[model samples]
Target: MAAEKKTAIPKDIVALSFEQALAELEAIVARLEGGQVDLEESIGIYERGALLKAHCEAKLQAAQTKVDRIVVGADGGLKTESAEIG
Candidate 1:
């Protein structure tokens, strides 16, 4: 069996809000696409960008889970359900 691969997230990255992480990721992409960074720097930023992307995905998934759980009942009361959300 293959062990799951997990990147070690930097402490600073863990503290960043979703927006901050995304902005940094965008900048990394721009640098890579512009071909301004040297090979070493490009590799470094690409790794960071991967971490940022994963962080953003985790944040969005948490938000989606919360949103999916809440529903307004027929009686106009708010409740949570595990059922599939349309």
Candidate 2:
């Protein structure tokens, strides 16, 4: 028999790109809210959802430190600086 793929833990999910993590989180939420999963499955889904949420939050927190820079005045050049977007 083929081995079943294991779902990632929350920490592993945090390593994924924002888009990838968000997509997985959305899917988990849909499954939980769909009302079709059994109690056991629902519990598992809820766990996964929590992990995804944590991963997404960590990702956002890490991204908050990024910054961008711009230069102006006579030369009208560009500069590098910390980005200030959340």
Candidate 3:
């Protein structure tokens, strides 16, 4: 069998909650914008920032999918039915 491919993302990054990831991403953006980091460090931070952004987006999508389902009534009024979470 082919060797399993390891993920590029660090475990720490993967473990971070959505809020934490977003905060880190914002800090990375600030550092990049400040123009103080050297080229190599900047590149590394940029990569991490990209990963953080992806993590945040994924968290948002998951939350959206988990939100309560809305239904339309026969009388044209809106109703919300409890969404079944799997």
- Residue by residue across 26-81, what tens digits does model 2's lDDT show? 99888888989999989887777777766676678775344576656477776676
lDDT of 3 by residue, 1-86 (tens): 01112235578988999899999999999999999999999998988887787777777877544458889889999988888777
RMSD of each: 6.1, 8.2, 9.1
Model 1, 1-83: lDDT tens digits are: 01112876778988999999999999999999999899999998988888888878788877644444778999999987777
Report, for every candidate in turn, its global Cα lDDT versus the true structure. 0.83, 0.71, 0.81
Candidate 1 accuracy as TM-score: 0.67
Tell me which of candidates 1 and 2 scores higher on lDDT.
1
Full ranking by lDDT: 1, 3, 2
lDDT minimum window of 10 residues, candidate 2: 1-10
Off by over 4 Å in 3: 1-8, 64-86
Q: Of models 1 and 2, which has the larger TM-score?
A: 1
**TM-score for all predictions?**
0.67, 0.59, 0.64
Residue 86 CA error for candidate 2 (Å)? 20
